[model samples]
Target: MPPALNIVPFVSVDHMMRLVLAVGIERFLTELAGFIEEDFRRWSAFDKTPRIASHSPDGVIELMPTSDGTTYGFKYVNGHPKNVRAGRQTVAAFGVLADVGNGYPMLLTEMTILTALRTAATSALAGKYLAPPGARTMALIGNGAQAEFQALAFRALVGVDRLRLYDIDPAATEKCVRNLAGLGFDLRRCASVAAAVEGAEIVTTVTADRQNATILTDNLVGAGLHINGVGGDCPGKTELHPDVLLRCAIFVEYAPQSRIEGEIQQLPPDHPVTELWEVITGRAPGRRDAGQTTLFDSVGFAVEDFSALRYVREKLRTHPFYADLDLLADPDEPRDLFGMLLRAGAGPGRD
Candidate 1:
């Protein structure tokens, strides 16, 4: 194999957006979910941990790291809901993939867009396993940067084509509606969360807030609904009322981690919850019956980020959105690192 320090493949924000458009966002999501499922099937092979976070009054910065023996990956992400008032995205992220054998960085990519894509794909994938079969509609409570991605992912993966949306800021809802208007979804702008969830088989709460906000209460949630709670990710931040969790069959990406960052934080430590991987692997049941209510408490995980990075690495082989980044110093004598820089300065134009 070639030396690992020679070059790194870097996928920037513009490149990521171009790649998403080139591959078509829906298709990309569908493919990315396939990758996520494949990794989940062999979940035992990975070295995992709950993301390490530093919380503050403004937002939270997190580091998610994991390894599968041969390869390793981690993401740096931050969430600040107040950023929107200053015309900034509420979340920004980037990730790295490295060869575990050599401990050398291999890929670095902008993950803000990729994170949105994987999150939606994972939600839709969980829906496929948790939602009622032939479910055709979903209520998206937070219509922000992630709303459209969730809408398209559901439409592509769960066969959902109708969306009911509600956001405190009408402009956010308007942006979501405008973005997805002609995407074939039967869009409904609801006056309230209850209105959005009415007659909908699946409800996705993706609001961005930094508190224990009850975006969904027991009264709003009816039987047979699959709820995708996406935003209650940091400590002291949650969406559903405790009663809603008590009523639904909860599913999570990773138990130890989800219990800390997901909706289950409200429940007792030993509260019954199912792992989504078991459902994917057929080791556990997903939806028991047509009238069953299921909740996928997703706070995002490192394994999903690893899988996403792997997918992008494979794509870089054919697609050209990646750049060769000189991330590490390459020395002719391997140990003569100082000599290499000296040789460069010793060239014709040297001082």
Candidate 2:
């Protein structure tokens, strides 16, 4: 351990899969949601801003940054739904957690999978506070990469044992159904989004189209439908109809950011919406009655990533699914920085 003080821990894709499988996905999502809830409770203690995005006709890439006074974190992620035509994933990502006191990264890990996990966890966490009591069925409108994770998270955290799935592509629906079978889910693969929403207490619109498409129209949403709107996460990309947004009691991660990125972006800037932290912290009302509709306008905020990074770092203590990288400079004398590199060539092992 020559670089014990300078080594950085890296969790590659294989290692992340091992770590997650070792801890069951349900248990992992449950614990991760708990961490998210705890951080949201102390929401005022951290720094947050809208993610910076570079948009394109194909897709978008973003950098989401956030920090508590003691630690800093950020994620580099991209969304290219059309990439599937080339057999590529719609989203790929990685993130870093750094020591604010020293300004060095303590963890660098693959976030493509982690992002799916966190997004599901955060959605279910919001549903816990906003969904109607004893809610069981959820309509998962987009059966892409994220649909399976969202179903499992709702099952684990919000008691959604039944799922009604619909996707524009029946192949995608087949893929979701195939993956979720034997998981104790009462699943229905529907041909239309409207048919999927029938009799379901919750409706989650996760379509990845890059425009203002109406995945959930005004007439489609039921009176008390708890909407987990996760796909409308960019400036030009939105899923809910504007009228649907107006009728629901919208809750957002951060108002300023959500106004630009979340479904609330469809409404005027001055339209009132509540910050979710207030409801989680008991300062605001959630689902005033079973008849009132509620929406969690999630744009995948930086604070949730901060909490996710913290969770992985803690799990690293006993989890050996990490490799060390020599990422820092260390010298016998703090001022003799050049000597370290010079000695490397002069050492016994030098070629």
Candidate 3:
């Protein structure tokens, strides 16, 4: 049965967890990546722009939006490194998918978990095309809330099982290790970023800080290694050094957005970069040689959120993981909104 015009499907956090658990996390990520890749292949068909962000001393809040003609979507997300100190999540989000014809919302869901999944999925999807072939070892820096998701997504999509983990706080690293235990990964907790990247073919720098910080220096980055820069997602928040960007053939989700928010923000405005969609679609090259250093400066994009919301909307068809929310006002006569409000106040037998 379909929902009423006034109703929209809402997937709550608990429902989202149940959905992922039911489908299996790795399988969910693998499937979600497929949707993202499908959308990227037709990348030229959608509207694109840099996410709208309002920055503050405490953190940043952003609105990411996109559309592919028939459908439209948007996500509301925030990043506050200090939120964790107050027993809150450092990143939190929610999103909506709507019908373009009527401008009516079709689906609404919490995106905090979804964003983590999509971000990891996007990272691993890039790894599929940009990471060194047969790369099995991955150095995962910044073992925070997103660490385990990134680890799992890589294993599912990129075939990485060996993980070298590190974080500024040892407790966060321990949490990641504990969560990933018995997950068939060869886990090593390294004391430093250099140690974590040592002998690894793919190094992911995902530290959570709002200021310019060098988590990966040029010397630590070796030839032929794929660097997934996940933390440098805002104007001042960066994880890789300028020298590292100069050394690698950089790939990004969207160039305009990445220039403002990705690791490439450190370089000159005219510095060259290949969008990941071009590489995935074979319009551009990725990892030309074995010794080439490739960087996927993954600042989360709106198309990814669009793909994720649509994926969840599709899953809701087979799985009962969502509830119908009365989100729209459907007056009896469409134009009689005030009459509808009057009827509600009239109580029983009002009509």
What TM-score does candidate 3 reach? 0.97
lDDT of 2 by residue, 1-351 (tens): 364667889999999999999998998999999999999999999987678889887888999888998999999999888888999988999999998998988999999999999999999999999999999999999998899999999999999999999999999999999999999999998879889999999999899888788999899988988999999987888999999999999999889999988888879999999988999999998889988999999988899999999999999998878999778886788799899879988889744
Candidate 1 vs candidate 3: which has greater TM-score?
A: 3
The regions of model 3 sitting more than 4 angstroms off are 1-3, 349-351
Best by lDDT: 3
lDDT of 1 by residue, 109-223 (tens): 9999999999999999999899999999899998988999999999999999989999999999999999998789899999999899998999999998777999998899898
Error of 3 at 287 (Å): 0.8
TM-score of 2: 0.96
lDDT of 3 by residue, 1-351 (tens): 744789889999999999999999999999999999999999998999668889888888999989999999999999888998899998999999999998999999999999999999999999999998999999999998889999999999999999999999999999999999999999999999999999999999888887899999889999999999998988888999899999999999999989988999999999999999999999999999999999999999999999999999999888889988989999869989999998888868733
Clashing pairs in 2: none
Model 1 lDDT at residue 327: 89
Question: What's the count of clashing pairs in each model shown?
Answer: 0, 0, 0
Clashes of 3: 0
